[model samples]
Target: MSANHPELLKLSSPIRCKILERVNKFKAKIEFDGRIEYAHINNTGRLREHLIRGKTGFCLRFEKPKKTKYRLFSIEVDGYGALIDTWIQGKAFERSLDLKLIPWLKGYRIIKRNVRLNKSIIDYLLRRGDEETYLELKSAVQRIDGYASYPDAPSIRARRQLRDLIRYVEDGGRATIVFMIGLRDVIGFRPNKDVDLEIHKLLLRGSQIGLEIRAIGVYYDLHRSSIRLWNPDVKTLI
Candidate 1:
C-alpha cells in the first residue's frame, strides 16, 4: 500500500451538514447552520444507502454562482466517510501517478488527457519511451453488503470504453481500467452484475487479455475536506 500524499492532506475543511432529503439522483436538500439549501450531488450512483434523511455529510460551497450554490461531495456512512465526487477520482489518480504510488506506471508520463481514440475519449494517454498506455478512470461509489461495485446504473458507454481498451490490447498496446472506489472500508471490488452484466463479462475478458484492471480505495477526510487514497491494494473480486 502507498502512503498518503502530503499535498492532498492540506485541503480546506468542509462544512458539516445534515442531509434533509434527496431531491433526485443528482440533487439533495441539506441543512447547515440552520439554513436549508439544495446542493448538486457530484456522484451519479444510486446512493440510497448513504444519502438518507438525517445523515450527516459534508458540502463544499461555491464562491461563484453556477447551476447550484453548493456541491455535496462526501457523506458519512457507518462512521466512515465516502468521497462521492466523481471529479476527485481523476485528480487523485493524477496525484498518485505523480507520486509514483502506482508501481507499474512509475516511469510513464501523461501525454494527454481525454485523448480521442477510435470512438472513445479515454481519460489519459501515458507514454514512456516507445510504449503508450491508455487509461480510463471509473468512480465506484455503490457499496452493498461489504462489496464495492462499479456503474451503480447501467451504462452502455462504460461497456463501449471497455471494448475500446480491449482492442488496444489486441493491437499490442497497453490499456488500464481503474476503478476508483470512492468509499472506504469496502471488503472487495466487483462489477455490478445485477445492473450491468455485459460490463462484468468484459472486465473478466479484458483481464484475461492483459488489460490491466485495478481498484483503488479513496475516501474523504472530514477534518481536511480533502480526498485521500485509502487503500492502495484494494482486492479485486473479479
Candidate 2:
C-alpha cells in the first residue's frame, strides 16, 4: 500500500544503532559504531517492547547534550521504524495541519499552541469561522493485537488531562483528544484498558458526552528513510 499523505519529517542525520539496555525512563544505552553510547529517550511510556536488548534503533546527534549525546527517536519494528519521540510526533501533527491532510480538521487554524486550560495545557487552540476548539495530542507506540495502544504504563497526568477535557466539554466548550499512533502498521487505535482502566472509562464517558476523539498514524518509513503520514484518520476502536 502507498502512503496516504506526504512525508511529514525527515530523519535528521540519523545514525544506525542497536539497543543495548534501557538506562531509565528518560535514557537508554545503545551501541553505535561498535561503541557503547548513551541515548536520551523522549517518551515517558514504558517502552520495554521497543527498547529491547539488540533491537535496531535510529538516533540523531543532540545539538547540545546535557546528559546524553544522542536522542533515540525510532526503533525497527517488523522491518519498519516506529517513531517513538513524542516531540517528533507533535511536529508531524503540526505539519499535517499545515498541509491540510486531516480532512476532519480542515478549515481549522491554530490560534495558539500549548494553550493553558485550567491546570493542564492543551496542545492547540484552533479557530474556524467563529468556533473554537481545545485539542490535546497523545502518542501511542505500544502495539497490541494489531492495534496501536496508549499508556504502556499508568499515567496520572494523562488521566488529569482527560478529566480536564471532559470538564471543558461539560461546560459547553469544544474539545478534542487526538492519539498520535507512532507505528507504521495498525488496525486502528484503542485505549489500553488493561494498562489504565481509568483512561478507558474516561474516554468512554467523554465520547458519550460531546468530546471528539480521533487518531492519526505517523511513522518512520524505513524504505523511504523519512517519516510519512500513514493514516490521517485511523479508526478509533473505542
Candidate 3:
C-alpha cells in the first residue's frame, strides 16, 4: 500500500465463486468448488446492476458453522472489485482512524461504538479535549459511470438518522456523516436523487448546517483477499 492508501485487516482468504441467484436482500445462492450453496449477503441495496446471475465474485466461509456457511464479500465489476458487505465499511473506517489515515479526523479518538442518542444509534462517538463528536457511517455500493451513489432503495431510516445528526449539531455538539464508497473506480459520491429524493434533500440541508460530510473510496482485491483505500480525497458531488 502507498502512503495515501492504507490496507485493512483481511478477515479471511476469499473463495472464488459465481452468484447463482439472489434469494433475497440478505441471502443468495452461490456456486463454489462445483457446489451450490446458500450464503448470506450483508448489503441491503438493490444491487441488480452488479449481482447478476453468472457474475464472478469472492466469498468468505464462516469461521464457525452458523445458519449460513458463507458470506458474499465482493464482486468483480468491469475488472474492478466492489465490496458488497456493509459490515466491512465501519471496520475499514475505524482502522483508518486508528492509523490516522484520515486527514481531517486525525487526532480524535473513538470513545464509543454504536452510541445511542434520542431515537437513533450513531456509529461512533469521539472526543478531543472537551469537545465531543458524534459520527455516522453510510455504506455506498451503487455505482454508475464512475460515480458512486447511496441508497439504491428508499431509506426512511437514513432520513431519520440525518435528522438526529442535525439536532446534535443544533445542540452544540459536533456531528459528521461519512460516506464509504465500496466501488474501486468511483471518482466521487452523491445521494441517489432518483431513488430517494428526500434523502438527497436532507443531505443537502445537513451539509448546509454544521454537519461535516466526508467520503472515501475503497478497493477490495479478491486475488489477495485484501481491502485498501483507493481514494483518500473523495469529493462531495452534491
Candidate 4:
C-alpha cells in the first residue's frame, strides 16, 4: 500500500450484485432478475462447519446486477471453510500476484499492452521506467491442509496462467501475479494440494523460483457499506 499509488490499479465493487447477500443466518428476500430466487443455499460439501456463500468463484458485489456476472471477484468466510480473500476494491486480482510492489509503480509512467503467450492471452503488459511487468489475477477460494494453495476449486486456466507467468518471469521480463484474498479471515493462501496437485505444484514452484506472491485480507461491512483490510487467524484444515 502506498500513499501516491494510482487508483487505476485498484477496482471497486458494489453490494447489490453479490451472489448471496446477507448469508450468515437465513437470507431474507433475495432479488434475482427483478424477482427473487431461493433464499437458503443447501450446503453440501466436506468443508468444515463454515457456510461457503458460493462454491467456486468469490463473492461478488454487483455493479448493475447484470453489467457483468459478478461486480467483483471475491470470496468471504461463511459457516465451514476458512475465510479467504475479501473486499477487493477493484481489478487488482488480475495482476498475477506480483503487484504487491505498487509503491514501486508510482515513480514512472505505465504503458499497457495485451499479448498472447503460450496458450493464454495475458491480461496486460505494464512498463514503468526500466521495469516491464506481465500480470494475471488469482483467487484463494479453497486450501488444503499440508500444502498452501490459492484456488479452492479446480481451474485449468489458473494453472495455464500460472505457467505462463512463470515462463515470462523465467525469461527476461518482470512478471507479477496478484492473488486477492476476498475473505476477512484467511491468514494465507495455499495450493490446495489435496484437490489439485498440479496447481499445488505450480504454487510451490512459483514461490521457489521468483514469482512475487502477495496476499491481502478484505473485510466487508454492509451496514456502513465498506470493505476494509483485516487479518484473522487461520488454522490448519487438512
Q: Which candidate is the best by TM-score?
A: 2
Worst 10 residues of 4 by lDDT: 40-49
Candidates sorted on TM-score, descending: 2, 3, 1, 4
lDDT of 2 at 10: 74
What global local distance difference test value does model 3 have? 0.83
TM-score against truth, every candidate: 0.92, 0.97, 0.95, 0.58
Q: How close is candidate 4 to the true structure, as a TM-score?
A: 0.58
Q: Give the winner by lDDT.
A: 2
Q: Tens digits of per-residue lDDT for model 2 on 29-130?
A: 999886999999999999878989999999989898899999999999877889999999999999999999999999998999998998898899999999
For 40-72, candidate 1 gives per-residue lDDT tens digits of: 987777777778899998877788848778889
Clashes of each: 0, 0, 0, 40
Candidate 4's residue-wise lDDT over 1-238, tens digit each?
A: 2122222233344334224344333232244456534333222122232334433222344445532333223233342222233324333322312434344344433355356768877656666667777766454444344323455556788789889888877886677665544444444665567667887788678777787665544434432334444432233222
lDDT (tens digit, per residue) of candidate 3 on 52-165: 999998888888858789988788876657887878877888888888888888689999999997889999999888878999988888876678888899988889999999
The residue ranges of model 3 lying beyond 4 angstroms of the native Cα positions read 1-4
Error of 1 at 201 (Å): 1.1
Model 1 vs. true fold: TM: 0.92
What lDDT is reached at residue 204 by model 3?
A: 88
